[model samples]
Target: MNYTVNQSWKILLPLSHLSPNYLHEHQLFQRQTGKSFLRKIGGGMDKFPISPEILRPTIVFDNEINKVARALGLKGKRMPYETANGTLNVNIHYYFEKYIVLDVVFKQRISFGDISLLQKSRLSSYPEIESLVLAIAGLIVSGNQQSYSPLTSIPTIRCFSIQSLDDNQFSNMELVEALTGHIEPTQRIIDDVLARNSGHQTSGPIITLIDKQGVIQFIPNKPKLTKDALQKYSSCCNLLELMLVIEQSIKDGHLDSNNVFLSALKSLVEKPEDIVKSYTAQRTIKQYSKDFHLESRLSDLTKKIELASSVLISEKKTLRRGWDEFYASNDFFQVLFTALVAGLVTGFGILWAFLKGL
Candidate 1:
């Protein structure tokens, strides 16, 4: 669960491969399982909690504590050597990791005046949000093409965060500097270097964002990554928008529709007051429409709300149907596995006859 090199400057992060379709499939499985006949694998990614302060606990590599330790013959152990241009290529790993430069982050606590259900959910939600956010860094890394993808570009700007335990407690400056040192140059930087040299080989440009929120989401500054606008393990606000985002995420090998759907459900459920609001909105519209405009306007508004609700309900059904087909095919062993065995026998007979003739 935790890997620590030094107790003083240790980092905490979760371990998830963030594979494509995992979250979506999980959502489908959960829904299917809730049904009378079908089985369920688990709930989707949306079941994961959300938080306000996303913390991606990452240690700084530019500080190169390991090299520093070695040079000064310090007793403490630093992980491996991680130089950008060094033979070991530490900078590349940090670049892919999208680690937040720890030099600027500091933590301050706000007291909860009193405890209640709202306070509890709000407070408990943060750590969950923080955990999920860290996964984003890995997700972004997985999305990078130039770093190691056929479908992605080196992220123009990679973002992460470092949390100081307390105010003025940022004693890890050396570590911070060492880690910052290894942050990779971006393509823009490389082009600039090339321009300066008139086409000489040089480093690329790199952008880094550091937030004191303590959230671990490794957001990229590039247009594509920035445009994603997806919540961690949650679906997008718009189904089409979410799908487009998921399509890209899938290409980068982080598809998770299951999580997206679960996120969808979570979002839908969050608005219990919506049901009340819907009635209120309808009444408000009815009251206002009686005095002004034609029947066409009332009809149009009704049609629009009906259309919105229909779309949401239909989308849910469509997701269910897709799962039905998906699970049926994927659960080959759960279905007519005997048919597969019979086909094997039939094919073997044909092959055996051919072999005998030969």
Candidate 2:
């Protein structure tokens, strides 16, 4: 809530380090990377790509950034910094696998009164600091979709709280809760087009990362797969619920399944518009499956026709060639005609002589 953030969170995350360890203990941290497990199953597994939201970059002291990063957990990554009024101010840039990207902005603000924050004010469910962390985590998970199968990547949206009390650009920082669930561009740019070999990659070899942008590689997937497996398989429920969802999309001229997929994906992230950018893979799959079936049928028919034509043509050519070669020297038709004429002449002469003698 705006009532409290004006004074307190400065000592909350970094100085106190309360949220970082909690982030690491998350079960998602227990999952393997794309390279390790992806190779074993090839393209078969659907593991979540979401990295733990706990990223604590090295904080620098004594004018050297390197020393600070090693102290925190950043073994060897460069620090993000900006020059203001001839002074170099550095902040921790924490990136997650699927959810969010955020800078642990450390600012120093002068204390004013006993203004500890309004004790009686109700807190808004959506808080800015929590929002950034959640957003970045969503990004990393959605980024490496090839690892997760049909489970879609959550979008990366950001929210941040200033560690310093100075009333500068950090002054009117708006309060937000839904990280990737909401829209904020300062926190949403993705690194794309990871390359491999010269053989023209189809959809392979692209890097799987989760940045602030929504699910990157393909269309974001639907969340219906999350419907309780028990419900999905139970006779009390429609055993073919998913099957009908697919069948209707194809034969019934209905795009309902696709809409559901999109709706659920949008709900996963804070941004409603990001849903539009995703490919309607479910719809495309339905349409393409039908096309593939038709094409296969056509291909089989064409092959049969070609085989018949080839057999008929081969027989005709063989007969013509054989006749030409066999008759080349014989001339059987001419011999037969000459023999018939000689027989008739001989017969007539004999008959005339006999008649004259008589």
Candidate 3:
């Protein structure tokens, strides 16, 4: 990391012995003639138009990358190399003892053809191509970069489609992946870089994803337990009890039998947050069961009340009809009794009058 910055001329001097024409052409190319020269050589096939504004930033970016390469103990040089398709502007070359890392950056959108050409440019004999890092941005006016699926299969080459080259920025993971080439070491480097950049120490490794927009999104290494799961877990006495319940539910087919969900639950039992979530979910289920039982009871009571009311109404109607029928049958007897009472009263009155005359 403590290497001095060597001049570009000094680096180009060594390449003179290797390829004089390549060295001279590359040196001339770096001095602002590279793009035009490539365009002329391309003969209308490669349409990479460079704006003045972009050209300045690209030069700065190239210089910054050379510094980074030097810091990593690799000799850096800017060169325009020939490819099968046409001439490509290989901006930065990092020379190591065993292999050479070539960096090709484009201000305009890069095509799959460009990538294929770079892959073909690899020399079979001398310094093996260890890594081929291609960085491109701006509008993709032509072929789809996604069609080059074979690039992902190759471990050495890395393709980064960025938003812009203003910051010359790269994700911590990208840097680590390009440098270390191992997962564990790359993760360690990522954590260290993140901790240094943020100025705050982190306990565990940070997982990151780069979006289509070239934005770095950090994903938490640990899984987040849900509130419902926490509630369910609270009802359980301990983790082991929760695990037993889950196991029984799985065996009885009460829970979803999807292996993925079951596997997630099994993994969740180990985490304290997940246990709390489980308790919350259990409590919610219990509440729902109680409410359902109450509803059922109310429904049964209503049905019974309706049946009794119907029976009582039928009985009252029958009693009223019976009384009406009795009145109708006793009508003749009621008239005969009235007539007898009247006749007796008249005879009594006549008898009283004769006694008074005597």
Candidate 4:
């Protein structure tokens, strides 16, 4: 039975980290409904049907356009057109309920001439086109969510294009191949950014795609690295050494092993720079050296200091206890000694008197 395409049938591409069971369930749902999946597009088309100039410029923008189309419940079609730029594959999305069409043009490198050309396009008269222009401008400023707002609420025909200098790295065939899930176009962009910014202290600009709601639709999740794994890859020597110290503290019951290890691992992964800075500062202190003898001496010194404090406290407690006992017993020992001394002196006086009389 043929099913009519509806809003419910709108397809969402699987996130790279989706579980296999979720993917399988989605496949089953598609089969049961006899609905076409988004990934099936371009599979039956002739490979590289368009010129490389047009394909490369447009393909990088497809991921964002696809997300926008899906979110707005619009169906997308690739139409071929001839321009001075080359044979452009313009994507048109039809919103049946609103009776609106959106024309998305992509220029690997946009120029003032290109903007003028787009202004002359047939759909330029629509009010939505102005919003589309602003949205595209926002995207160009920073390929991030802060640049754009949702355009789906504008219920009219709209036209926009992405202009970027990085369009040359991909070709039409590669973009078409990506549609069939044979390659990940988003990952290619990330790899390109990383390649361009290799060894740089600053992070590269993050390329993001937004939906009609101005929500970021494409964000790559960094791989979660474990403590052991991070130690193996750490560039700072002190991180691993500190991990050893923390581990020893855990073993000696000075720290909660699970909590401390997790916290350390998180900080190492999320804020390695902070850790490196702290480690560098500690290394500057002579007493913080990693030499075994030095470390042992420091540990021994800590123990000796603690022992001296305990001894002082114990002696104070013993003296206080003795004073309390003497007061409570009415000084019996003191009185007995005094009596013995007095009796001896009296007997000696009596013997002297007798000797004198004789």
TM per candidate: 0.18, 0.17, 0.19, 0.18
Q: After superposing candidate 3, which stretches have Cα over 4 Å from the reference?
A: 1-18, 21-89, 92-103, 106-179, 184-187, 199-358
Runs with alpha carbons beyond 4 Å of true place in candidate 4 = 1-37, 40-79, 86-100, 106-108, 111-204, 209-358
- Per-residue lDDT of model 2, residues 95-197, tens digit only: 2221122223322222334432121111122233223333333323333212322212222212221222222221101111111232331322211112111
- Model 3 weakest lDDT span, ten residues long: 4-13
lDDT string for model 1 (202-288, tens) is: 112211211111112122233343322222101111111212222233334332333443343234334323322333222322222
- Model 1, residue 98: C-alpha shift (Å): 15
Please report, in order, the local distance difference test score of every candidate based on alpha carbons. 0.28, 0.28, 0.30, 0.31
* Local lDDT at 199 for model 1: 26
lDDT-better candidate, 2 vs 4: 4
TM-score of 4: 0.18
Runs in model 2 deviating more than 4 A are 1-53, 56-100, 107-358
lDDT of 4 by residue, 1-358 (tens): 1111000001111112212222122211121210121111112111211101111214434454445444433345322322333333332221111111122432222343323222322233333333443343333223334234533332222122221222223232332222222343466664543343233211122221111111011111222322222221121222222333333343343333244444543443344444433332223212123322334533544465567779999999999998888767967678778889999999999999999999
Model 2 per-residue lDDT at 284: 24
RMSD of every prediction: 22.1, 24.7, 33.5, 25.8
